[model samples]
Target chain A: MQSENSSVNTEAKKIQTSKVPPSEGFREAFLLHLADTTLILTQRNGAWCGHGPILEQDIAITNITLDLIGQSRNFYQYAAKLINESSLAPSPVEKAGDEATEDSLAYLRTEREFKNLLLVEQENGDWAQTIVRQFLFSVYQYFLFEQLQNSKDDQLAAIAAKSLKEVTYHVSWSADWVIRLGDGTDESNERMQKAIAALWPYTGEMFMQADYEQGIISEIHLLKDRWIEKVKTVFEEATLAIPENIFMQSGGKNGVHTEKLGHILAEMQYLQRTNLGAKW
Target chain B: MQNINTDFKTNPINNKASQVPPEERFREAVFSLLEQVPDPEVPVLSILDLGIVRDVKVIDDKVEIIITPTYSGCPAMDAISMDIRFKLIEYGYKNIKITQVLTPVWTTDWMTENGKKKLLEYGIAPPKRSTNNEDEMPKCPQCKSANTKLLSQFGSTACKALYQCNDCKEPFDYFKCH
Candidate 1:
């Protein structure tokens, strides 16, 4: 049930007139993965816009927030197009209609419909926690975008290529903070350790391939290895210990998220839900 | 928009309609025309100077121009594409198409030396050539002093950084290297 990477080899053809098409399902899932991850992470980062430790840092985090939202908007637009064009069965949390749009997809969807990684949706704890979360996610995303730049889907590839540059900066910025905080004062080091313990389990969910991504599961694993290597270097420099063989949290990709996600969705969707279709 | 400017339209340099010499000549004309399209945010640099114009193709009377965006969230790209279209239309070109490509991905390396100079002259420091040199401090555009410190990683926009000169004590924007 592998969906063909149409941009790569057009010669390979398959005929499956029966059963729900894998391509349709995979596309819906994958696009949601893109949109939800970016949207949630944007919201998380946006929380620090005016509240960063310093004036410059506030503006820096806000810029990253805007970039994440911009990337999510593109993904949501593409997802809406896919859903609109196909007769794919809607998930329980999704409502397909003629009014499908990026805004509707983002603001109208229920909590259970989102497919973001759990790491992003968790509460932006302390400054140390936030940086730790950002560092881990940005490193994974940098590798993800690099691989996705060669996607058979030209539009996705374009989006990936454009976003890769932004995420590269995010990784570097967050990694620097990680080193500073991890190897800094005793209090900073303790907080960094606690942040790592809280966030490490969520990292596992990022590598778990969805049904649509089954074809590229091995590729993702390779990227996961690269992510690990990159993180290993940062940890070595920061004097932080890498967690191993622990029980990893799961289910965010399947629209099942922790309590933090529900609260986030409430705040994010409130304006849109209350003032339906209000335009700025 | 300005009375069609018939004289400007007929001028070979302005209109680019001097009987097509070759396909290459037509492309050259289009490139020269696009050189007039400046970035909306950084007006000192033309889209061509910024290395955003990827390619220009002429098929019979139809023209296709390809451009790439510097950032995923760059709002200026919409304005830039519109500016290209209007500028070409003002020159009397018909059936013009603008396509955006993102394959090779944009880097500050694509920005022309001239563009970098313009950025500096405009009081904003240009990005360094290398992406990995994030730790290296950029010299102040106003003072030309490397004693500047980064006040913020983000600036007025996503592409620049906020910095202040230690020598001249002047605050400025540094166009971050992507």
Candidate 2:
């Protein structure tokens, strides 16, 4: 019989070793979590490229999407290289001929194969909703990158250091928008509050430790405190309050995602799946 | 490709002979040749001027030029690699390889002084001192005014911020200090 799905550490490790070495699986999955989260969020943000409310704001969000895409590519490239090198099982690695590329990782994986957080896959409901989602995630990411800059892995550390600069801007821009919309017209304020209520449940999964990320990205609860403090100040300035004791969702790190993820993959992976390695 | 150049067997790498290793000579020649490959986005700046080229090594007559991406998803990198490959091949180097490294990330601070000057002359304000100060607006490249207001932190490109000169009433891109 298979082990309980709720426990991702041991079962996931056991299941993974049939294909890869335990150490390699851990490192590869850790890279996937980072890469997939940004790649999904960028997909969400990138939908605003031509359709944003205003030209300037449209360009601004598009630019941010570009930066996140860059970050995602870096992580995916590293992950691909890792997978290419470490797959002990030749039969499975040879399924794709032992060539795992950034494109394959992004465009080929099934919903359960993706390790992105549920926070990013939530619908971009309205302008206020999107901004709130970005505000919450960017605040968390800013601190995460700060801690990641000191990672024992040189490649991860370098990527984090480079990404911290970009995330700094994302945090500020989203924070400003949160405040602007929260204190704006009554309709805007109502929508902002509603978005926060809808999105807050997904925020808790970010701090939950996945088995693969144990040593690679540790001290999740410490980052949570700092993340809360920063968000609290911003929310207070925006005349909003940090909500209390909500039921938090988890399992994204274990690749158990929401129904939204399936739809996202359907749309995003269409071109790649249909054509298979079609290049411009 | 030029009259000034000698054959690879004849030591075209600046007259330095067996005293310098063949790989080092190939590296030197490649570095100078790369100086001629302009960044596709900012044509005034070369890959060398932009500081993306990290290291050059030659292994068994294969020239490898190592570079770091300025941004993770920078579109220019593909073109730069292509340009580099074309330049190397044109220069009679048959086996050339381009490698991208990411341990030490690229930063605007790595850009050369001459690159900065060229950027200013090309009508985009060069990156200011390597400080991530949002309050400090760069001087206008057009009017040379200190009074500038940041319109948007995100500009036409990932490495630029949109700003407007208060005096000149003209908007310009400020090369971001990333």
Candidate 3:
């Protein structure tokens, strides 16, 4: 781990000291969107480390957390590389430098700078809420990554190809739970429905295009129907129905976020902020 | 071994190759070395068995080892890299370089047959899949029964799933298929 090339340490470096291509701004933002979403959700799930309802399930969610963390790191490493190579911000060009290590990028960024979806940063209210959240998010990720696997960008394609298999498991696991609890007991079914109502409004942002995603993810509009189809299938099996005409709140991808993100950032950044440049 | 030169990874027998290229021969030696570098998480297996080490190359004075991660957030990767470095250093090789790549992603199919056998002997069921996808349950590592039930989709580590043998009634880890 002490090797200079250790994945953990290589990302931490001196400040911006080189020239960057202008075209990479959108790409960098795209990468952060992926990384921040996974990292934040992982932070939420990590809170379940010792508190899972059952031992096996606790391990399952924790493992899911670990897997998402790995995925997030891959995205952050690529984003950091892009940032290091090029400021990626045409205007500010102030940060995302050689010093924008994955650690710094994840820990030092403020809520306004985070580009994750509001759905992921939502409170893990209960086990059912988490399950609903995972199901909705995983279905979207599975479809998105499917398209991304063939991305023209080699690194992005590589990441998509690699992580899609894991995402498939996430989709299956979450969907299975959605079905199990949605069709299970009277109380369980009621909880699943409530979770869906509360969370569905946030999911539309997934299909909506952010400025940075325009050229890169040109086909975002098409993914929505497919996402709906999959959700409908799972909901049907779970004996649930689609809600109609709900307003879709947007802005997480645009760097505006729910206040929930602030509390998450505060808790997550506490250790790193309390002691600057600390490493284990 | 420390008295010997590790920077020089070429086998003495392959110094003047009559058949294979010196680079190919050098890679074989490196692969053999990596075999000795056990996976930090699964001590029963090496990096090669885990299919994380993608390729080995020699550039100028340095030996470059390319690896891919098995899971998105596999904590073992850092420790595995450290182990490889220590193993190389122990062999007296100084100009070593390790790079991580993610393409043609790794799968359990890459596990050497010997490695799978080692896993079974380690009280953990090796990765398994039934033909036609009839069942996903793994055969019991202890009793070799196909009558195992899944206890958890996740086990102690990210790469495995927990299963209990219905017959033997022993809860064991399955080196799950990716």
Candidate 4:
């Protein structure tokens, strides 16, 4: 069997030379964006794995977290492949510094390196809050993935196509929960609205297009504006009002994240970092 | 359809090939047979159509089929695995393994064109490419109408969405492009 270091090196070499289209870098970034958001939220939902308010919901939340984790892994793997194609060329100074491997990059990245939306990193306020948060995020993801399926980049188009199917279900599930909770009981409705109201400020971050997004749209023909329209439609159907507050929180795409991201990275990277090539 | 057993003669396990172990052939046959098993959620589609079947390996005289679930918490995974095992066992392969691969996640782009057609025929709009260019909007399966509204993000199954066809005014399921 090959040693772990050798395996890592081999994998790194594979990533460095992989074939990814130049236009697909934005898709890669988008995948990383989704992965980071899902990873953080999955960690947060995991906190409620055994301690949900009800049995059915307990299973539901855990199930959603697991789904996000699965999706994150795939997106990350794809991101690694994309990065290899884009940034993995051998160094001019062969002796000085080499490009990082996908695994190494994933394992060694610091809190500031992650690019997930702030809505995901917020504390799971309560059952109502969690449901509303999921509903909102799923709506946005569903729209984004829907548009991404038509991406010019084949690999990203393919990934978006596949993930869109799963996200559709996720959005549906979350929407149903939102409706049930929002319209259920007097107390439940109030709590659900409170959750929605509290999280509304963060929703704008998802729609804020940055320079990278602009490049993706102008050059690659990827649609960021269309996604916003789709998300707005879903919100209307869910009987939720779109907050007119244009003052939206931002800074995940550019690598600025909430304070909670640091703690999440510490926990997620603990086993791989501490062990340093340790394998079961 | 005929029961799988009566379709193929039960060749003596040792009679096929002495050089290449029968287990290897059995594994291949199991995979080939499994390639026919349509995804239960989308009956017109096969698991291979979605590219969820990652690797099929023969180890210790057992056929192990690796699948990546479409969604991490998809409830259908258990059913799909069980169905794979049942279908293979029915074909006279008793020892089978179904492994779930969580890495390199499954994508809808893997769905075969044939599978996409089937999805459309089954009343669920197929996914377009991820680019969201206006040219790629999937027409409604039932009405063949491009005038469709995305009803909900989630669908009856974990991999679909609810869409309403403006032309036909019918609410139908759309197999999300993932």
For candidate 1, write residues A121-206 as lDDT tens digits: 98799999999999999999898877777666667777888898899889878998999999999999999999999999999999
Looking at model 3, give its docking quality level: acceptable
Best by TM-score: 3
lDDT of 4 by residue, B16-110 (tens): 54676776776667667777887877778888887788888865555668887777556567778878877876766666667765446576777
| RMSD (CA, Å), each prediction | 7.0, 7.2, 9.6, 13.2
Instruction: By TM-score, rank the candidates, best first.
Output: 3, 2, 1, 4
Q: Better model by TM-score, 2 or 3? A: 3
lDDT of 2 by residue, A1-280 (tens): 1344675574333211122223647888888889999999999999998998988789889888888998998898888888878744432224876488888889888888899999999999999889999989988888888877877677878898888888888898899899998888888888888999999999999888888876666556667888898988988888876778999999888899989999999999899889988898
What would the per-residue lDDT of candidate 4 be over residues A18-40, giving only the tens digit for each residue?
13333435665666677778777
Superior by lDDT: candidate 1 or candidate 2: 2
TM-scores for all candidates?
Answer: 0.81, 0.87, 0.88, 0.58
| DockQ-based ranking | 3, 2, 1, 4
True interface contacts reproduced by each model, as a fraction? 0.63, 0.69, 0.88, 0.31
- Ranked by TM-score, the better of candidates 1 and 3 is 3
lDDT of 1 by residue, B51-128 (tens): 888988876666788887788777787788889889887777766777876657788898899999999999999989
Off by over 4 Å in 3: A1-24, A87-98, B1-24, B129-136
Model 2, residue A127: C-alpha shift (Å): 1.4
